[model samples]
Target: MIRKLTKDDQELLMALLRKEPALNLFIIGDVENFGFEQDFMDLWGEIDPADGRIKAVLLRFYRSYLPYADGPFDVEGFAEIIRKDNDIHMISGASEVVKAFDGEINFKQVKQLFFAELKEMNNKISESFSSAEPIKKATVQDVEAICALTDTIEEFESSRNGSRTSLRKTLESNTGRTYYIEREDKVIVTASTSAENSMSAMIVGVATHQAFREQSLASRVMAQLCADLLHEGKSLCLFYDNPHAGVIYKRLGFQDIGSWTIVNM
Candidate 1:
């Protein structure tokens, strides 16, 4: 039976996460904040009448994103839940689920699958190049600056659609981090990371001012961000649909784990 996940399900979900470490952290964190609602279901395979073992589970996010993993569950029952909920954009992992819904509804294999990649950092302090400018962690005072930087990046990359509201949500979360480079007191470059799980994080919203395109500030900020995350003992993960960005990340020691496609329903 598909039903809303309650506080009682937190332990179940966490256990499931341990079984599937690659699950997106945002979704995991979201479930922790707002448990499943009536429109969605946490697909538990089969409930044992006796011990209540949640064989498998998936969090249906606002009927918008459905990710199912860590299961020895009933695929048909899960698909039934999706059909009832509707408007679910995409599901990650398990090709069988994809196949089940392939022709029944509009579906696309457009998610970039990622695995943990490590780059050892040397505590060696390199010369900090002063640009008559400064790099700083974005504060609430820089709301406009932050939004402008994010819009610039999204405009440059058509596939990268980020909302100021969403960015603000992360900024206010306190757990995430956003860094900026300012020149002549004007924000010129920006980068942000979302701490997904205890040990993993994703970098997004990397952008540079138009006039500063060839200046390599983006790379510098990226390098600094990577160093910071590594220092905190978090494994860095990045996603890019653009081949050029992928190439740049490769040069910076990020390896491509797999490809993912996102379908806009």
Candidate 2:
């Protein structure tokens, strides 16, 4: 049965979420940063009666995001539970779960994504982009450039459905990093994490200028960023739907975990 989660269940919750860090990045990061009890957020779960382990998990963020994860789920039952809420921005998680959900819930946009992870780097990628643009971590001095890049890149993201984040706040939070390749003072490629925790980091904002594709600029920045995070003792997680992009990441050592889906409601 599905029920609300409380502080009393924190340990039980963390245990389940940690199993697949890549699939549950949002759930793990929010719980780590904001705690279990908050005025605007609520978490619920389905428990397996035989073993008492959580079988499915759901997180609702004030109608902005409702993310779910589980292998075996009663999608219709859970969909009915979420139907009671309003203004839900999206429902996201395993493609099977979310796709099944989109069939039951009215939605505005339905997106399919592939989730992958790299436990170890194949070999040190030569950062020797001697003749190429150098990848550097963005400082507060680089916010405007980052924003400009995002604005242009996002437009091509799914015919204008790409999500845009305030790079301004990302820099202010000081929790994650955005690495980019700059050519003659112009930002061309970027790789960054959208959420992070002590054990994991979720990579997002990964894009390259169309003119710069096929140059491996994205690979370079992503490799460097992943190395840095690995040094800090964090595993890397990312979601993508492009086969070409998946090849690049696999070369750097990421393997497919599963299908992740996002439905804008």
Candidate 3:
């Protein structure tokens, strides 16, 4: 059976989500930050008749839908819920699970990326992997500079989708943070996290200036960011489709857990 979830279901909902915390970082963060009653967010669950326990979870945050299950689930039933909501512009989650919704959801594009998580740092990676200059954690004042730097990286050019307002809001809300390296007063290398909660965070917007590419600048920034987050006892996760980028993350102690798919409607 499928039903809308309320705060009363928090215990059940969190139990399922925490099973793979890194993979569900976004959903966990949203629930932690906005909760179930928000107009912009809603949650639903599929319960098993035999156990009366949640077997699948679906989340709607603004225009996006995220779905997850430990094993087989009623994909068609969840897809039905998504289809009835015209406000939904995208559906994203573990690729294997999300692909089942393709025919049910009207989407115009699909993005597939390898999902990875970092639980511990590799002993081989020395702290010296970071830049000689300390990486700076960004503040509201760095929004414009970060956006400018974002615009230069092909990988993240469309990642933020040109939303400076959103970027600014993220900074102000403390839901996210950016760690960067600057050269000659210009922001050059950056690695940021979004959808941060107490247990996990998703790494996004990793970019380095074109001139700084071969110098391991991106790795430096990412290493520092991941190290700090891990030190705080928060696991980190990221999405990457580029093989070269995958190599860098592997060296930083991230391993592929699954494939993440984002379908745009």
Q: Best candidate per lDDT, number?
A: 3
Better of 1 and 3 by lDDT: 3
lDDT of 1 by residue, 1-265 (tens): 4444577776766666555443345555565545555444453434435676555565665556454544445666666666675556666543443444555555654454433344553223223434545668886678677676656654545533545566666778765788888876778888888755565677877888788987768877877887887787767776676777776676667775544444455
Residue-by-residue lDDT tens digits, candidate 2, 1-265: 8888888877888888888776777788888888878988888888778988777778887775555655777677678778888666777777766776756788888777888987888665544444465678888788777666766875445533323345656666866789998877888888888677877888888878888888778888888888888888888888877898789889888999888777787
Q: Candidates' lDDT values, in order?
A: 0.62, 0.77, 0.86
Report the alpha-carbon TM-score of model 1 versus the true structure. Answer: 0.75
- Count of backbone clashes, every candidate in sequence: 6, 0, 0
Q: Which lDDT tens digits does candidate 3 get at residues 1-265?
A: 9999998888888899899999989888988898889988889999889977888999998888899999999988998888888677888999988988767777799889899999998756756564387789998898888888888766665566755787778889888889999988899988888889988999988878888778888887788888888999999999888898899899989999999998888
Candidate 2: segments with Cα more than 4 A from true spot: 64-70, 74-77, 99-109, 124-134, 154-165, 210-212
Candidate 2 clashing pairs? none
In candidate 2, how many clashes are counted?
0
Q: What is the C-alpha RMSD of each candidate to the true structure, in Å?
A: 4.2, 3.1, 1.8
